[model samples]
Target: MKKSLFAPIFASALVLGLSACGATAETAEGDTATAVEAAQPAVYADLGGEPTGPVYRMAKADTLAVSGFDVVSYFTGDGVPVEGSEEFTVRYQGYDYRFASEDNAKAFIEDPAKYAPAYGGYCAWAIGANDALAPGDPNVYKIVDGTLYLNFSEDVATRWNKDIPGFIEKADVNYPTHTPDEHYQD
Candidate 1:
């Protein structure tokens, strides 16, 4: 008898699909769109001006920074935001980061400033545009001068690309103003 190695993988995929379907069906009135929108984790939401020091922009329910994506992989690997595993993790500036490998995690611990995204993982374009704090999509990013900049979306990223240097300058000036201690004041 011939044995297929893909059997387990296929079964796992099927299980995941079925579970996802179950979740979709459980939404009120079969409103998949509303369910999806509600299911999405907000990038950042103001918590009554509560102070968080220098922590990165993370969802209230999220414990990992950059939505648990490996930051080091963006620079060392294919520049694709790969999800990080809990096995290899690090905590910096009140935010936890997961890494694809222990080596990446160690590299981050060695020089966190080198790997952490700019503007505290908030949307770079929004910072430059109006000093607004918006959730940054890890997938929509760029590495300029060894610095990673994330945007709210592809459209916002395109706007930032129009003048990267100019926007960077503006963002640099505006970032400090939006720091947790600075912006979260009454």
Candidate 2:
């Protein structure tokens, strides 16, 4: 099946900065001006399913969640995160997540919330401590209880460790301020 080329474009806008419901655009010609219809809520059916919750923050490059890292790898095996394989990729929460193997993909399909990162994969320090949006580095991560959390970097990760429990508490309270699919809310 063919993919929806427009989905990524709208999804990118949603990730970078755009309205949660839909984005608007304008066009003008001669003297008459027209406001084009706002982007429809993209279904992303080709991504395996429609987005269910808050929009996931994609990695800066290639726009893949966890920068294409296999989220399932964080919990299984040696506990070392591994690069995901294109052959076994799955889309969850509006982001395409790659896996190291088919089993990993199946595992993710079984329970996405269990493997998905906190704060929509935004930086733990930024969300909890600052209530801000910052890129999360898949390389710097931690599994607290059964939930996964990603930090901006080693330095930020170190800072976050200073008060993991406190930060988690603050993040939980702050996270809901913005809509699930939005990085920041009005």
Candidate 3:
């Protein structure tokens, strides 16, 4: 039997086409965008050297949410994570949110859920891809459907962009079960 090169090409094309079809870009409001916007790389700083204290987590951890960046800034500013200041802060749902301005802090306090990142600030890709808990890099993120989602790194954020809606759905489903405590036991 002779092997056909076109067979492999056709298979590859079909796979690519199908994968593209499966990807969806939905706005935070659940409305689909006609075209997915180019992902803006998240800006972050290394806060690892900072003192560890009571912080927010889907699983108990000593790291602040979104690396202490102003969550409200993602939506209000040029869609970049603005480093927050300690002067303006709000504690909501066991997490402390630092704000770049008093106004941003006030806005967040009004509706904390609206500003908080998905998956308790854990890496969205990690949760969706493996149901594992990984620290979400404040500098690597995406805002989908008006919601903020963080990834472990810029590479993971790019991968997560491939199937934003799909990953969001998967992460949503897995988040409740895959917590820090749950993973620690395993």
User: How would you order the candidates by TM-score, starting with the best?
Assistant: 2, 1, 3
Off by over 4 Å in 2: 1-63, 180-186
Candidate 2, residue 20: how far the Cα is off, in Å: 27
Taken over the whole model, the C-alpha lDDT of each candidate is 0.71, 0.72, 0.67
Residue 173's lDDT in candidate 3: 85
Better by lDDT, candidate 2 or 1: 2
TM-score for candidate 1, residues paired by index: 0.66
Tell me which of candidates 2 and 3 scores higher on lDDT.
2
Whole-structure CA lDDT of model 3 = 0.67
Kindly provide the TM-score of model 2 when superposed on the true structure, using C-alpha atoms. Answer: 0.68
> What is candidate 2's lDDT per residue for 1-186, written digit by digit as tens?
024546666666664464444444553433422122333322222235554334444422233577778999999888899988776767775577888888888888888889988887788888899988777888899999999999989999999999999999999988778664564321
User: What is the lDDT for 62 in model 3?
Assistant: 28
Query: Which run of 10 residues does model 3 get worst, by summed lDDT?
Result: 38-47
- What lDDT does model 1 reach? 0.71
lDDT of 3 by residue, 1-186 (tens): 124545655655665565567644567688764332312112222222222222234333323466679999989858888988866756664455678987988788678778888887778888898877777878887888888888888888889889888988998888877433332211
